[model samples]
Target: MTDDLRLVDVESKHLDDVYRVRSRSFGLLSAGDREEWLSDVQGFIDDGRIVGVVDGDELVAAARIWAFQQWWGGRKVPMGGVAGVVVAPEYRGRGVGSKLMRGVLARSVEHGYPLSALYPATTVIYRHLGYEFAGGRFRYTFPAAELRSLGGKEVSVRRAGPADAKRFLELVGQLHAAARISGPLVWPEDKVAEWLGEENSFCYLAEDGFVVYGWQSGKLRVEELVAGSEATARALWSVVGSGSSISADVEAYMSPDDPAHLLVNKEADKNTVIEHWMLRLLDAPAAISARGFAPGASLEVDLELDDSELAANTGRWHLSVSGGSGSLTPSTSTGEVLRLGSRGLSALYSGTPLATMRRAGLAWGGATAGDGAIDTAFAGATSYMLDYF
Candidate 1:
């Protein structure tokens, strides 16, 4: 009956079955916001990147992934964002979801994607599937003591509207590209309109449009500081300093290298560090070559990936990169190779310090702290999924 649980590419005939599966799995159908729920499902189908688990003639489980442009060092890297992952109650825990994920990841590689990212519903599930928590969302309060430390200078703040949508999108794209990591930059037209309509949510342009950032006030207190440069980002941050009454709410991931990261440290209060964006390398060779490389000599890296489902990526690969131009090939070298588990690799993929992983007791065998090429190649990268898939 294992073949009965076959994973297949969704087709036109499976729409109704897939819809019913999604409805039963997520409990979104006939729930509040019917229109929104319907739209989400239809949008995924329209985009045509969904995979399903079939049991005989019935579709029992479903997962959705979208291919989009992600920013990486002034270049738009193709990314496979996995989301809407679901399984019916009957099919739950039977490896159906995992099978779906593997299929999707394989498709990502076939489609020439270097990196595949996800904001996981459960981090642990994705871990075994070869995903690791690469980034953290720091939720801090806008405490009174830290108030003075912010907003010292005046920043010309302006409201963003439909007219500014194109520029806002462009600026955000630029910011993500320069950061060498994907930021949640892609927004559908509807989401963009809703964001524009929200009164408390305002966009601030800095340095005569050097950057554009967004902030939201109220129960879901949020601040998204997107900018082209650190100086412009800091200038935009000053605009929010005027609001002293804003109590500590949820503050999402602001880059650790950014001025906001520095200010948050100076004003750290009761905060929770929630992990965001789980990543799995579909093709170690492609993933490495997809991003920009350091300006240096070539270094040979042997990466052993543990993917039970995808046969092509499961073995040892010899990667060669010179100033970032590289090729990955299966190594016939039977010599001792560096071994890294999925979690370690995912952490490494997102620019997490190799030392930090060691400190956390996550071991990378045959590779030492002195291995600067591999370390820099792994840690020099960062990714943010700017879009909700």
Candidate 2:
């Protein structure tokens, strides 16, 4: 019976079944939400972003790949954001989910994405698929009155709507690159425009900062707030805190080192929610080439990487980084090999320390001489993202 199950492109006929499965895994959509869900999913179907497994007439499992460009070391690399994964209760113990994921990975490669990431419901399956913990989406809560005290009113603030998406991206890009930030993502203009136009969110813009937030449970819920300078940071937080008359507190997804934290009267309380995300390298050389490196980091290290899912990535490769850029090339000459699998490589790609990878048993089997250089090349700002997709 398992042998008869097959993977297929999720189309109009399969949407209902896929919806049911998604509901089972996540939560059921209400009547109006279901219609909107169908409208939303139609875009994915048109773009061939969803894949599913079928058992004759029934769809047993499904997954979706979101087209994204994630910022790694201040550079944008095409990434496939995997989500909406689910399996029927009867199919839990079998290899059905794995089968569906293999198809998703293939589609990701076919679309030319060099990396893929997901917030895993569970880690074991994705770990086996070469995804390792790469970064976190951090949510910090602050006292609304404390934010209200930080004042920078001289800076011009304006209401931003769909028309400001391009400016928003441009400002974000400049800030991320200049800071050499890691683990943020950029949405294409159309999607950002749609997001800015969402019914629930209130969007605000300044010359160097922007914030998208909404009210939830009598508190300000900040979807994102990026500021490039101390003045803008204060101005933006003041804009958020202006709601303190009606709201007691505010919660935001923030870069741990955001300058706005310095402007606040007191630090946010200890109760922060951190959701970890995993990364998988779809094409090793492309990933290396696309990533930004430490400005003064200079090194040449040979690596022996074994990628089980993507055979094209299995081989000895030469890695070199200089002047804030890096490259990976296949080598024929035998060299000092630092051996690891996709998990180690992916973790390292996001700035995980070599010693940590070794301690976790994710990496080993090569000369230790290249360790320092390897770490230096990959190390930078702590990997974190403000958005959860």
Candidate 3:
């Protein structure tokens, strides 16, 4: 059924067709809503991001790659965030979605993005394309009053707007570096302005931290809270709980090791809603070299990667690490080989322990001796993403 379809870069004129396909794939959209959606798609097309599968003149399926920088072991790495995937209702069972995703994967490699990530509505399709479940955006809920007891010296914070975009990015970079995070998205300055201008949202900036939140059903909902220092962490969290008298609960997106959790007075019921996200290594060598490893850890191991989608990644690789840095080289040497599929390797790259992968049947064979070293080299704080899409 996909034999007659052609994959191409979506152009400005294709916005209407793209919107129609998305609306039908997702659900009905009002005229006003369609215009708003088309505007966003047009922005992506103008930047040469959207890829579409066309049957003659009709856009039957589409996907977009959001240019992003994601954190890995405290280092920022280029990431292609896949989103806005849609297949026409009539074409849903004809393999159009998979064909379009393959096109997107190829485009990601050509663009030099070593890694790719996405919040999946369904895992089967992405997993088939060599993407594996890697991390999550955790949502936590607790009483606002619990945060009132956290103590800190007063730190001055002021309202922030688009003008503060640069400072906000800098602060988040600092915070992520210190926390040694994984899978957090870094937005461009212009996009920061758009976020600050969102209706009903409130943003505050401090010397070393920032908080963006809004009201939801009379409760405080924090979209993001990044702090580089203890004082900043306490100050920002206190602000969220300051309205405890009126708002009963506060829900926020946070890392599992968020400092605010430690500051609370009682054992609050923390509901961690894990929104699963997947990862794929478009360029294995580049991805390996770009990632940061544990300090004082060193290892050398051979990997046999099985990647059916990207031929360049399917082979034996010699991975070496020292002093929190790593390098990868194509190898013919028959050393202790750790065999796994591309999806499994992507999961391991995101700090999933080698032992866990073996137990899950994603990894096995040769050099059981290197398991500890592999674990230590990739180990870091838990991975989390605060941004969706």
Candidate 4:
């Protein structure tokens, strides 16, 4: 049965079939918004971004790749955000999902994306395909009243529209760079336009920050709240709290150490939900070379990468870093090798501490001398993703 399966690019005609498989795999779609959801899925199909596994004419499994520019060590790195992974119920346990993901990895490299990330429904399948837990989307819930008293001089904020896309992108770039953020995604112009056009979404732009939010069932939901300055953070969060009388609580996607939490005057019930995200390096050399490291720092390390899925990544490599830049070359000399698989390497690339990887058994067999330099070169702020797809 596996021999009969073939992976193919999903075309316009396959949209309905793909949706059926997705609905079945993810459970029933909402009756009211099915058409809107289908339209969104069709857009991905029309863009030639969806891949599917077919068993003779039936779409057995599928996934979509979202073009994104994600930050790493203060630089925007091209990222392929994988989502909508679904397999026909009948195809479960048949290895269809694995094949589909392998195809996605190959296509991502073809598209020139050095890195890829996904919020995984389960870790088993992606882990087998060389993806590792690298970051998370952290959701924080607190009473709106607690934020109302956050005191700060109000900065001027204006409603934002598509006209502000370029400026918005610039602001986000500057903010992420300053914060040394990792895993925050930057959308393409078309996506930015779509986001600005959302009827229910509210967007506010300040000189050094921005906030996008919406309402759901009488609760205020902040889709994103990015502030490059403390004053901006307090002001924007205060705006969210301005609705406290009508909305009981506010839930927002935020960094683990966001400053807005400190501005609140009163303690409220704080709940943090972590949705784990996995990452993969599609092109090991290019991915490493493209990353931005610590400024005025330098180091050298040898790595022995084991990538059964992508043979090009297998073998020993020498990495050199200087002044926030890096280069990777094939190594001939035998030395103390950091023995790791593709997943482990990816985790390290995303700033996952060497100590944690060591405890998790993702890394070992390295010379102890270079470990501190390796850590310093890659270490920065905690990595987190605010976007779901």
Pick the TM-score winner: 2
Per-candidate Cα RMSD to the true structure, in Å, reads 4.2, 1.5, 1.8, 2.0
Which has the better TM-score: candidate 1, or candidate 4?
4
- Candidate 3, poorest ten consecutive residues by summed lDDT: 263-272
> Where does the lowest 10-residue lDDT sum fall in candidate 1?
207-216
lDDT of 3 by residue, 133-190 (tens): 8888998887887765565558888888888889988888877876678889988899
lDDT of 2 at 386: 73
1 against 3, candidate with superior TM-score: 3
Q: What does the lDDT read for residue 21 in candidate 3?
A: 86
lDDT value, residue 380 of candidate 4: 84
Residue pairs in steric clash, candidate 4?
A: none
Of the candidates numbered 1 and 2, which has the greater TM-score value?
A: 2
Worst 10-residue lDDT window, candidate 4:
263-272
* Global lDDT of model 2: 0.88
Clashes of each: 9, 0, 0, 0
TM-scores vs. true structure, each candidate: 0.78, 0.96, 0.95, 0.93
Residue pairs with backbone atoms closer than 3 Å in model 1 (clashes): 141-248, 142-248, 181-382, 182-384, 183-386, 184-385, 184-386, 185-386, 351-379
Ranking by lDDT: 2, 3, 4, 1
Which digits, one per residue and each the tens of the lDDT, describe model 4 over residues 285-339? Answer: 9888878888867987788999999899999999999988898899997867888
Deviating ranges (above 4 Å) for candidate 2: none
Instruction: Tell me the lDDT of candidate 3.
Output: 0.86
Error of 3 at 155 (Å): 2.4
As a whole number from 0 to 100, the lDDT of residue 370 in candidate 2 is 70
